[model samples]
Target: MTKRSAGTTASPRPGRRRLVIGAAVLAAVLLLFWQRDRLSPRRAPSEDDLLAASPAQSAGSAPGRDQAGPKPRWVGSKNAGTGEDAEASARQIAEKRLERARHTLEGYVQATRYPPGARPLSEKPDLQKPHSVAKNTLPLARPDHKLTDARVTLEQDRLYLVGDEAARLVASCTTSDGPARCEVLRAEARVPETMPQASTMPPARVAFADEGAGGSTIAALFAPAKEGFGGYHGPIAINLDLRIEGEEGAAQFNVVYTPAPPARLTGDVREVIENGSLCLYLRLAVDKPGRYVVVGRVDDAEGDGFAYLEHNDPLGAGAQEAKMCIFGKLVLDERAKSPFVLRDVEAYLLKEDTYPDRELVPGRDGPFHTTKAYPESVFSDAEWQSEERDRHIKEFTKDVKEAEGELEALP
Candidate 1:
């Protein structure tokens, strides 16, 4: 009967039970302390940081898989070259955008000059009837700087603009091994205060082939007007950038410049007559004083996937009409038009005086997917075409209404 009470601890000789429990708790705390140094941090990442760290995440690839990084909402995938590489997707969205931009620029180029006759060139067999240069108060020629079939040097994994024509202008590029990585080449043309007094007169009668000598994409940047040339001379500068992408090999481009008032513009009419181009007369007022750069560019894109077209032209008499084939070839359509026409062009200014090195977009040679520069001023498309004015007005009204609705909804 003197055996320890049923509920009492046999070892509790005065508070021994409480001391045993305390020692057990101490052992547990020591165990936890030994492992506390192995934890990680937790916080949300900024969007840019997330993108900078994992460029391919949005492309549906596991992070770190894509070198072009994430595709920006503004860009679209397109193919703008020929040969085996033509089948490859352009890492830069500029490839696709350039196509759209060319349509617009084609309009300008056409407008700048006249096709050989009033009728379409394809319908006219006497393509050389009254041979003449396309008209442009402000004319542009393939610069002395020329480029060749863009050669992707497999050995170096870089691209070179070579060939007899490539020797004209100075340019350079750097390449990489990745598919999206493009060896971007850049060339600069300093716009003279006046058209350089050329030893060679303008081509007597300029002719543009559906397939021209220049490769898929090309750009021309005009500098501030220099001294000498009258009427055509002024503070105006144009930086035209263009390219063509997609399965269509045909390149189209256009640009419209309204002469500042006090500076009148006139055209030879015959110049544009040969090209079936359009012309516009603009009266500009120099409310602002500055030099402007008006730019134009083009790209001959070969469509891919669903964009590929196939057909052949019909031969005469007993000859069978060739099935029109557009496989990776550009086809000219009447519908393509210009994308942008900037006025009051000024020197490019940024938060940083120097141009920042942008990340090369996937399938591109540089971070910027497109080479087209933005308008330096708050100008509108309406300034280019009266048709665009109405749309611009509607857009403004919609914006005002949306802002009002948002204001009303706010607490």
Candidate 2:
């Protein structure tokens, strides 16, 4: 070992050099781990962790030493899903939609402007139907069959003009089963309310043949008149006890009758195309003078219903007139043909500023007025318009647009 060759170098200290290299490698590995942790993002404490901290941090701390802090139970609830959370989001979206719909309808009901004769005409609603309580429906079954239901109707006009001729009452009798006969066993009349004469009156029988497979007729029951009970004045209750020929029990039918009114429709009716509308001037024998409302129905040539017409005004006693006008566009929309029939008519006299505002008039039996066939070119097809109707339609349109934009932001 002491003898050295001229070209050879001294040997290295292998054990000492290896120890130094090992220490340096360990330090480099730790440096890489520290840099990686610093570069990546650190998570914030969850709501649960914040609630569980503070007091615990102070209690566990001491001078010159740090205690372990609360580890996050969860990263965040933003990504932590639940069924209840999904339901709450859905509920918020639905409530917004319903509130928007209510606003749209409120605007529609506020607008009431319409064209002339523009109001729809039809029968009175059940709430306004006179003496609706007196509609007689009684129980009776056919003698021959168990489930054979029989029905009877005593039909009368709105009023019978007080005159020499008796008020005609027609009994419409029918059976549910096929082809059954019917007859009136007995009939009588009584006033619905307190009247001066309250005695029951006999109903004279009328002979008529059976009409249809399920229908039979009993005609002519006169309105009662005596001393204080003038036949002319009645809100009379006509009670009819009847027997279906093959049915067992008697069927009791009743109808409330109005026998007289303050006014009557006369024999004359005149029609003309006035102001591009069909106007019918109804002649009236106005025995009592006051406000009058004349209502009627007009039908197309083919018998399809077209328009409802009404004329409201004040009048004096004796011969006077009221005209029911059909709007021009109504006929144009219907594309109606000429010879339009006035199918039905009714009239009432308004009591001068009273609670029972109006009284009934006789209803028309059939088509009351007929017009000469006029060409379709006479009418205009344009929509009826006014300032109020125009403004309401535009405002409602804008409401719909604003609601749509708000819906887009929701899930």
Candidate 3:
């Protein structure tokens, strides 16, 4: 009986040992899995994994799924094949540049016509106080010939009249002629000028605005100096023969000849005749020869008023006494409620035989220079004052260094 019991115990021991080994293997496998989970980098689920984890549903009604298995996630990136956005951005930038250029040109024209008080300190000339009109020194003369050979040039969509003969013809037309007569001649001239012509002729003046923008027609006439016109040899009368370019229009405007205070629009001074051009003639009776200003509301036929214009004629020493024609461009807009608003004004000097050959007259003292000085009161804040002071000091130091270098280079 004892031998039989011992045999049974040995068989049970082998079975028990096998069971213990199996348990140990299972624990080791679990530990390896835990270590891998803690140490290895986690990866986003693949498309297949996502599909397997998603709840089972009808193929047609799956969540976040279209006809395809899954909807594509959109990342913020531009497609290589599509360039429409880039092209549109570039076009907008180009348009802005063109607009800035046009405005700058208009401003220059207006600056030339600014009055003494309105002008920058550097450009302002000496003038006498307000005084009564003296005897006229020059007799008014009109353009005798018709502008038959004038031609038009379209640049940047703007129309400019070009032709020496045409300029001479228009310059000859006397402002004394009633506005109706002047308008007739001007309209007649435009008819032929608008037609195609040779491109060799020099540009006389800008005649019309770009398409869809407003247009203007201007003719400046000079009268021969009389015995006492001003104290010097300048023109006795300056006739601004102007008409709206596009359609027939009219507006009430006042012409303020500086030294003489601003005056109301009187029939004798401003008359709107049937033809549409406003014939503005200024008879000079000043005691000296210097710069003068003419300010007023001279509207085009479309009710667009003249903003500003600059005219500089460098007459030959000998011909300064003769009648001289000055051509200039001006800015006009319907947005300007007051003709007195001065912005982007400039004056370009025109050269002609009647005038001397000289450098173009400087319109303003310096680029970005203005008559108004910056006030120190603006720098009341310590931070702002400090920053500005530092900037000015830096500029001054740089200027001094440059001067020293220039001096060293000089003999």
TM-score of each: 0.17, 0.53, 0.15
lDDT measured at residue 182 in model 3 versus the true structure, 0 to 100: 20
Q: In order, what lDDT does every prediction score?
A: 0.24, 0.57, 0.26
Minimum summed lDDT over a 10-residue window in model 1 is located at 161-170
Question: Candidate 2: minimum summed lDDT over ten consecutive residues — where?
Answer: 56-65
State the local distance difference test value for candidate 1: 0.24
Write candidate 3's Cα lDDT for 1-411 as tens digits.
Answer: 445654455456888989999999999999998897666532233423533442323211212212234422212223312456545433443344334334333333233332222222222222111111222212222244332222221111101111110111122112222222223222111111222331322222223212211221233221111111111211111123332222221111111111111111111222121111112232223223333333222222333334222223222221122111111111111222222222222222232464211111112211111112212222121111234334433543453454345434433
Q: How far in Å is the alpha carbon of 303 misplaced in model 2?
A: 4.9
Deviating ranges (above 4 Å) for candidate 1: 1-13, 37-288, 291-293, 298-411
lDDT at residue 87 of model 2 (Cα atoms): 47
Q: How many backbone clashes does every candidate have?
A: 72, 1, 21
lDDT for position 59 in model 3: 18
- Candidate 1, after superposition: displacement of residue 157 in Å? 41
Instruction: Give the winner by lDDT.
Output: 2
